[model samples]
Target: MTNSEWRMTAKRDKVLSVSAPVPPEQSIAWPRGKGRALLPLANNSDETIRLHLRGEDPDSACQFGFSLPGEANKSSGSVTLELSPGQVLSLPVSITPPPPSLLGLAPQTYHFTFTVINLSQKERAWTVMGRLKSKPIIGPGLLGVTGICLIALFVPLYRFIENRENREDAFSATPAAEASEAGALWPLLNRGVEQSAPQTPQLAPPDLESLTYEAMFKEVGAAYNLDWRMLAAMAYQESYLDPMAVGALQEMGLMQIMPATWNVWAPKAGVSDPFDPYSNLQVSATYQVYLREYFSGKGHPGNKWMLAAYNWGPDNALQVIESGADWGDVPLHVRRYVLKIMQTDSHPVLSDPRLQESVGGVRE
Candidate 1:
């Protein structure tokens, strides 16, 4: 069935045969944070057909989700159902927003591939898109906050300046100060203002911390057969890999290793000082090895999950997995942390030249 208001973004090519044929168009776009649309399909074959429904998005901007019509819950990737011969079905799909970022300087579009599969394993696929419109680098809300601060700062300064000017006028224009024993002559007309040299600020020198730990990262990575860039990205997220850095939670050194974590892992890393670069990286690398294996053994293997486990805690990441939800279910901070690590100089979006030479984190 076709509706007057909605446009058909994609359609299955040829009649529905034993082989699943994918659609020609793989990309679709709409202008908003969230979107809802209906995709209609028909089973034209002579026999009853059981079809599989699956949905996923490109790696570049993957903050999207899909659900069947009237479904109570939307799960990640795929769902299953049966369609009788000559039957027609209307599939309803919805997309969620991408991660929050100041990079919303331009419209952000995400693509989700919707596929319908037959028992033959051939499938019909369409790339559905949801667009998030561009936002100002400094939105009105931030501007309003800045304006409020300026008003607070300037209003008092205005009054202060006025009061000083008035006091000076009173002192110079009137003879009361000259007549008083305690007050001396207020010289206004005969005096010239003295100019003084500006004082050099007494700011303390910043700490000298070694930022290059690439060699150590490579050594640890080769030992574990893991990508060194991923470790470097994690290090950047932790403390920008600053060996001398300290966190509010008393997390010390390059990896911002916590006191409790250090106690459990210090002996294994063979180090006493968390501020030592190699020792700190070694401890972190050891912990990451455990994380990687743990997630891989869970049958949900990926760098994203491992990083999420590291940042959000392994138990929390496991809960998300057990819950059968998508990445959207993760908290914003964890999602952001994972996204930053994945995006490198070669990333389709959010790239930097300096991010090159790293082996892996978020692969393109």
Candidate 2:
């Protein structure tokens, strides 16, 4: 052909066309929902291009969608599309109504052609490339990434500094936890069920007769859901047998009944004396049960930390448990104290002893 005649052929060829997957590729595994197929321009001539999709079937009719990478899509259908040689036109496609049955069926695929039409006189022969990209690669090596990281770190540090400044002026007295005899923080010391604490030498049995222990048992059983043996153990740890015995802190009665605890629970239980041994044991048992429920609900395993909270308070207990401070690491006295509570296995400790009692003392 003459050089001038060559212009039209090159221009026609510049309008690109392709049967996707070529032939023999009938189906394309498209991601569920909306997706796009890339139609790359190949005319090579630096020319403006106009491209559109022309479907073979009547169902394939929609505006030609344009986007970079895999984002271009107008609509999904089987069709032949026309395009300028040096121009790339994206076709939008969607996969709906998942295959009816995979049984005895070959995998499904889709094939389509995109045509690039050169709107202006450009290079001799334009070549187009098609790529189906699901997502664009985000390169962090680019600018602004360092700024994003700095912002993330600064927020938490700012919050911490603000809280510290606020605390300087507001926290004047002994912290809320230590200000009172019935310190809300008293639960921190009770180790509860966590056996991770190091065991201390067991407390010696108290001088009290079995009858006195039994009486202590009945009182705690009547007033609290806690096992009587646990109360008995605490009583031994606190008094050894001295009904009137007091601790170094002057804690009195069974379970080292703290004067603070007495003032708190006595009136609630309608008791006139916090020093009443029966009343004291009963209150302590009730407190233990409350702690058990509280710990179990916070998604923490076991009542160990919960009991510790009872002795110290919730905030202290959370610090110990959440910070991975194993109860075993605490002092021996603390460890032994928690272990004693867990060791009580006698009557009333089994919860519904009737079930065990009926099974000839077999434990569930």
Candidate 3:
């Protein structure tokens, strides 16, 4: 009998296991006005597995479909794929939001399911639930009010500066002796002016060397449905939660994501600032999910390869794996990076509750 395992690649570095006979239901949120999001499904079994997917409601406001590479017929209601042993088939499931006219101003929900059958004809199914919500739009009235507030705040400061300059010009018009007397008073006037000057508010700098962003790391992990400990471990290894940290290779932010990779994932993650703590964590999590999927699809245990790929680049990691080298045989720097992340004493991010539960309260 061939043993079979199933996994779903949702984000970049994350994969959710699917139980046999009946997998647990999963939920996702979709923002309105955005294009369809891609969900990757994989089969990690020794026996060939066939998949059949369909939606719960045919006349629902939302639309569902599948994209299979090399297959001429890509249909929505049903699609079939014969996945070989240890082979992963990426089934792209697309969700089309309902028109604003039909959806109105409220959020909506949609449902779908996928059924899988193995060589022995044992069948199992999994459910996908989605909530469709529209992005908030700023109205012209709010913009106008904000503009008026800015004018009210800055106009007086502008006039105050102008008046001060005019007064200085008048002072220069005084007689030499009067100017000399004025010069004696200049010190007092300068003191007064300095005391009266408005101070610009400054932002407090980030505590880079500290584990202050532990909550943020856990939040991003939960958002991506990943183990928080893994995310924390990676962040601690990369930048110790320092958003301003920069690697020698031009890698930026806490997770040390490459510029090129950030550019590809920023839009998908709704991140405008790569250096923001939340944005950095979000992008890094997404990239990790992709890495997990890619390595798992290639028939390798994703943990070690995923870490190596994150540190040494995906191509290099793949090359090392293809060469049949163990994790110790990987490049020295990559090996060290992977080991550091897997080590618990390296940082305090593992103390978080989510991470503790993920690793089963064990520290290694």
Candidate 4:
């Protein structure tokens, strides 16, 4: 069988399998300004599967981008693709080079890995590897020549200046009387300044629990065209503003997001540390936006369904909605999560003029 059509027989029912052509062992030399490439994937199993794709380049010299099956055409670092049994697909993978200004004199080789995970079986997955070569605008040979010329020009001048300065220092040494006079003048000039200046009291660090993280929440929420208050409320409900809090399911940081969620959305949100307050808030807001769009496409009410999906996974939330049940009919925990956010006293976020306008000035 051709590489594209190679299949592995299923050993058990409800098993999902995937196969892809091995990436070339030799590096794929990407030109400085090139945009992207396509990677073909095939689902060779009896079970339908969801694919969560994530890419990482240690040096971060290039941005990896892809689009999911149901998402808009925009490229992101993380995307979810649904593959039916016996389906073959060609997915576009984009490699965005660093800006010309950021490139160095020497050529750069970026090694990246794209990890594909079956969401249903988190532990089962595969990875594809690729390399990008970015040739420098000014090659190393030219740079070495320039450096040698600069050193040749400055070395004599530096030596002459240094010798002349030493001679001057030897000949123009300050007299003892003059030094003593200068020291006397220093005390006279500074007399009573220390006594006259008022003391400024030191301020203590702000309490972590009381900190609103308002600026970060507002920025992230605005980026996704969401209400800052709702985002703040979600954070408050999730971890009570504690960036280091851990949930029962091992969810970490202020948003209580699982590591799986972090792996997928952190790249898309342009965040490196999910434990950081700002990064956590940004990733959480991005996931909220995705959930909102996904549920809205399924004919569910945007606000309530989005909140439900944020608590329970989108798949479960949609199933409840499809069964003719509204937000009130959701599971107890999810209902409580939605109700808590809706009733939260978000005075701080609501006080902002931009947020006020976005939510029609609603006050709880």
* Candidate maximizing lDDT: 4
The models' CA-based lDDT, in order, is 0.54, 0.42, 0.53, 0.59
**Using TM-score as the measure, which candidate wins?**
4
- For TM-score, candidate 2 versus 4, the one ahead is 4
lDDT of 1 by residue, 1-364 (tens): 1221112444444445221111111112222234433345667766676677665666634433445545554646567776677876544444454533553224344445556666533554443322223233454544655565566556555655665587688765344532442221223111211111112111121121322345556666776666777777777778864555656544666677765677566556544435445666777777777788899998867677888887888889999888998889999999998888776443332232333433222111
**Model 1 RMSD, rounded to 1 decimal:** 20.0
Write candidate 3's Cα lDDT for 1-364 as tens digits: 1112122312221222232211112112232232222333555655666755554344565565665665443536566666666654334444455543322233344444343333234445554433333322433433555555566546555655565577688764335644454344445445544654433211222333343455555566676766676778887778765554656554666688776687677656655344556666777877777888899998875577887888888998888778887677787888877777767564466664443232211110
Task: Give me the displacement of residue 261 in model 1, in angstroms.
Answer: 1.5
TM-score order, best first, reads 4, 3, 1, 2
Model 2 gets an lDDT of: 0.42
CA shift at 93, candidate 2, in angstroms? 93
Residue 44 in model 2: lDDT: 36
After TM-score superposition, the amount by which residue 29's alpha carbon in candidate 1 deviates from its true location, in angstroms, is 61
lDDT of 1 at 196: 18
Task: Report the candidate with higher TM-score, 1 versus 4.
Answer: 4
Poorest stretch of ten by lDDT in candidate 4: 355-364
TM-score of each prediction: 0.37, 0.34, 0.39, 0.40
Model 4 ranges with Cα > 4 A deviation: 1-212, 344-364
Name the lDDT value of residue 236 in candidate 2. 60
